[model samples]
Target: MLLPTRPCGPLLAAVLPCLASPLAAQSTDPGNSEPEPAGPTIVVTGALESRSLQSLDTPGLGLAVDADQIAAVNAINTEDVIRYAPGLVVRKRYIGDANATLSLRNMHTTQTPRALVSVDGFVIANFLGASFDTAPKWGVLAPGDIARAEIVYGPSSARYSGHALGGVLRLETEPVSRTAVSLGAQSFFQSYRYYETDEDLFGYALDARADLALGSGGISFAWRHFENEGQPQQWRTVAPGTPYAAQATIDDALGFPLRIAAQDSVVDAREDQFRLRANQELGGDWELRALAALLLDRDGTSEPKSFLTDGDGQPTFVGIAGVTLGRSRSAELLAGLGLKGHLGDWSLDLAVSRFETLDDRSRQSDPADLATGLIPQGGIVTDENARWTTIELTVERAIGPHRLALGASYAGYAGRSRTAPVSDWRTAAPGPVRNASGGKSELIGLFVEDAISLTPALEATLGLRYERWRAADGFLQNAGARVDYRGRTDAAWSPKVALAWRVSDTSELSASLAWATRFPTIGELYQASLIAYGPNVGEIDLGGFDPDLAPERGFDMQVTARQRLGTIDLTLSGYRQNVRDTLFGQTILVAGPGEVPVSQSLITNIGAVETWGVDFIVAAEDVVIEGLSFDGNISWIDARIEGNPLNPALEGNRFPRVPEWRANASLRYAVSDAFELAASVRHQSTPERNLENSASSRCDTFFCVSSFAFVDLKASVDFGPFALDLGVDNLLGERAFVFHPYPGRTFVAGLRWTGGRP
Candidate 1:
């Protein structure tokens, strides 16, 4: 029988009318309505040019989740909000929300994220223009401590640099308005089906902020901390089966019911962070701002190997014990001075920053079981350091129905690293290895954009950007000596054009076209190491740079229609990204040392591919009720490689890890002035394709994971001197799995007291 698609009809029918009646009685300026009773429009790095939903000017899809959304919902992290956004997919390796990987538009650009992340206008991509995996853990700022988050989807190469191929996620913390001290605590319980196990989780957050105003200048400082130890999920192991099963013939003739073994693979994580910003008006013509921040994160996990089947229909054991550790520290200093006189339309920004990261992985078997050496009995450590310096000059002027902006940027990067040799765990004879790499690079870009208000209901935007980049003096992926792959520079000129026409007072039709390019990251080019979880028995080596490699280029287009009527807002968008010279991961059979005859997988670049998809959003506020509302988003995708070439299984096959359909919905009702209620459900469909085009789950024909739906409810009440909130997530305590076995039934409670009004 086909499983249930979704159970949202009843929830929506009950909340829609309540949201409509009251809004119809209020003002028509929906743009003027605040998301919260008392709070500013949620705007941050992602929405730099737009401050409000009505004033937002963009040709892309973006989401701004305010701090209030976090506080009222008792969110766990950024993942909670992003999980409901359109065109984004997330899959967890083990379970829980801790160690999951996210993909956008079927582009697994990088192992982690090719997407860029920044805060306060500072780029968070590491030295190689790759999303810093270590950045998120700099202690997660409590939801109450956040001001807003800006998520820009689709290619934005014209404005943001690097991983702009996928998109950019910029997080902006709320500025401290007054002195305040707040504390909150929450907990949850989760379960899984395959393993027949349950998880108990708990966490808390504490925040302190102070704002000081001195001589027409202001300084604000804030600190945040969060910690949680969740229960582990049981892993399903392949039981010992006959040769028929091992040879892939079990589906032809089934004899006995399948039996499986189970193992527990749980995860634990923690984080802490601090931030300070000072803004001062220097004279009447200049404004200066200085910002400083620090962050930290740690996660631990224990996993098992796949069930080994010998021809006898008996189970054999192969276990692995290891821990993955990641640590990163970043410091940045930026000064933005806007001229108020003379060249009043010009602004200058200068920045200097440093980023450092260390990743250490250790593995071992039962120590006594040398015959089944699951983990190579050794450890791998990688140390990275990067320095960034930039100077930006921008000039903006508004004339009649036209707005012109021109900018030029010059930036330089330097990176260095060291590696140690892998030794046998039994011997423990390891000394400091030699330096593997050191490199320096420079980038320069000149950009210009013009926004023309052709008519009261129409706007046109034209933009162009010219960029040059080069890298030299880096180590080879094969640990030996540094290579002189330097003096390499390439220049590209890209353009973007967009037209937005307002079909009616509340409807808009828009289209955009652009060209974008992405360069190889330092990690992909210079870093090489052996991964344990590869197809090969020995070590899976990540190869080094191919001097003939070229930049990946793409021509992308998108069309969108958005309409707002009374209390309902609907949006439909379709996009296509045609990429040339796309780089992909390939496994190559390389000859091993001596007569070993070993094989390994290496990374390579692919020729061409087309990724296309469509997304829809239907959000309504008071359709029938006064204080009730609901919103839902859905997405569909179709992506594949052009001509079947090197990889036959993948030719004409759907891209790996790209789910065709995913959706989410939420319902909210304000019971009274001092109380509110909310309920939400999220759903993601099974994949209609292959696993990187290789294996398929025995439980399902496709690489498809089982579909699941989770429900949540929250309530808040306020007395004269204090306010309190209680929420229940995964209310049914179902043994569900989305991305992975997420926390089952869970709940959280928090309290807040507002003192004197400013």
Candidate 2:
């Protein structure tokens, strides 16, 4: 069924006429009226400002963070601006971690492909891998350049694709209003202490921006350079109390004895980013906007601990085994153009965007032994590239008391990934070609939505979307073997409906229901296989591809209420979703006589899953005392797998990475217009299972990690055009693990200078 089974026709029929009657009555009134006096003229001057759809009118729960809100917090990275957002989490490992991704609702942190991220309506989520390995390039925009960020929860809007099943993050950059220049700098330090590892890490960032006004248009340019030295969060596991730990020999890798039981992988990273934006006013209420961004990132080296010995004096470890050294470089470019205007009684908007990964290269080395100074026997080099192009057109019109919108979008992607052997790890010289894979995908969607005002205080929205997706040109090459994979195509029709009732001027209640389908990405469909060796399972080949993998389909329902009482605002929301053909990685044991057992991991379809959650948010401004405020939110979620064909015994297992309870709260006090102080707290319950839900793979106490809580404090001072800010994160030094142990207490300080607007 395209829509929910519930009947909404009667409700629409009763509301539409009630909303139109008042307007009709006003137009037909025949009473004689006196001449109206002319009011003072108001001139709006700026860089081509256009009115777009508002989130408050959308079908889902939406949250907005403006520049003032962003500046009130001590945010080093752009993603940090949304760190305390309700029902959301940013999986940031360290200051310079490139794989930072976002999770919302009941989605797991590793399900990066299920969410959508955009900057100025331009797609930024990497499609090269479609998993945790491919995250949005947050470095492209500096936190200072953001004017506002909007987070829309769920795929309840016809304007978005099914990829927004988890949610969507839309970032808008600062627009040039007048000629101005700004400069900013920041420094940070952290004391990190882990099992047998202790160190102090530091980082710094520099940024500058220039804006110019020309005629009826304006242009802006921004640049940033960032560098950081991060403590080791990853460790080489030896299984506590295992025989390998007892037999392992210690070696000096970081001027200290490094044992297999307690070793860390340290990282050094840097990034450079630049962006240009221009907007112009066309004749007859038309406007044009363009944007271009470039980002470059490099991880000089990720040094692992030394764990191998040559039995002599020199250590014989390198690459994947012992003290390994790895380097990676990546570059991305994003460009877009948009046009908006009016046609008769209809408003039209058109945009075209292109995003490309210009270069993505990595090299690693592992020497046999230092005695002979021989080249690494186990070294590899990888190269991957991806490009995406999207075109969207939307038109809106009003009919009687109802507003209608129609939109069409087309998106396509092309990607290539290859891995080759390295003859010399030091020089990164190519030895022999190993494997290569490439693929292409195309998506087209058409949607229409109507907002009907049934009454002055009641509104209803009905939307439907039709989408078609296809994958083709899939091929894999290994050694002298070449294989052409079969192409796949799928189509789906999604429907959404929403109702909003204004209980009073200060209260509102809303409910929404939607059905959406998400298709697989190029990486999930065509990426080459992976292999790993385990102590218990030797030579495990995990490169199984299911060409017939089905698309995931889901239904979502949500209800929310918002109320304002004096200076306090409260919001409560509840949601439930059910999905079919959910994709997940699972392990299959392969055993034979006289050979070690092998556990092959592969992506497979799980039959069904369900998730339900409740969230509440409370905020008060200037309550009790002037300039004192409180903002907080709490969430409770219950997610479980209902069916699994491969292993029915896994049914009813809790979804991985989904904490049952999560909460965040903050209190802020403004000593004056120039000074402010704030404190925040966050907590999360322990997870119930791993990604695969394997009982045998359970960790010591919990499934994978333990419950933890953290506290943060921040202070800021403004000196006219200059500003200073300080922050202490994890103030309590809470030792928490989410796959990787989080950083301990850290300190940050920043200074900024801004020129007055012309």
> CA lDDT of each candidate?
0.52, 0.71
Taking the tens digit of each residue's C-alpha lDDT, what string does model 2 give over 1-758?
Answer: 01112222333333332221000000111221211112111101000011111232356677666554566666888888877677777777788778887888888776776788888777787655556677787877888878877777888888888888888888887656688888999998988876556778899999998989877788999999999877776655343343334445443422444454334556788999998998888878787888898999898665555443444644333322244568889998999999988888787889899988899888877633433434454688888888999888988877776778899998898998777878655565666667778889888999999877787767788999999999998877775567787788889999999887655444456789999898888777765445545452322122456656788898999887655445555566789999898876666554533577756566777888899998777666676899987767889999899988876777898888788998988788999999998888888887755755555323322114656677888999999899999999899888776666677788999999989566
C-alpha TM-score for every candidate: 0.77, 0.86
**Which 10-residue span in candidate 1 carries the lowest summed lDDT?**
39-48
Top lDDT model: 2
Per-residue lDDT for 425-468 in model 1, tens only?
A: 33344447534565666778888777677876567778888888
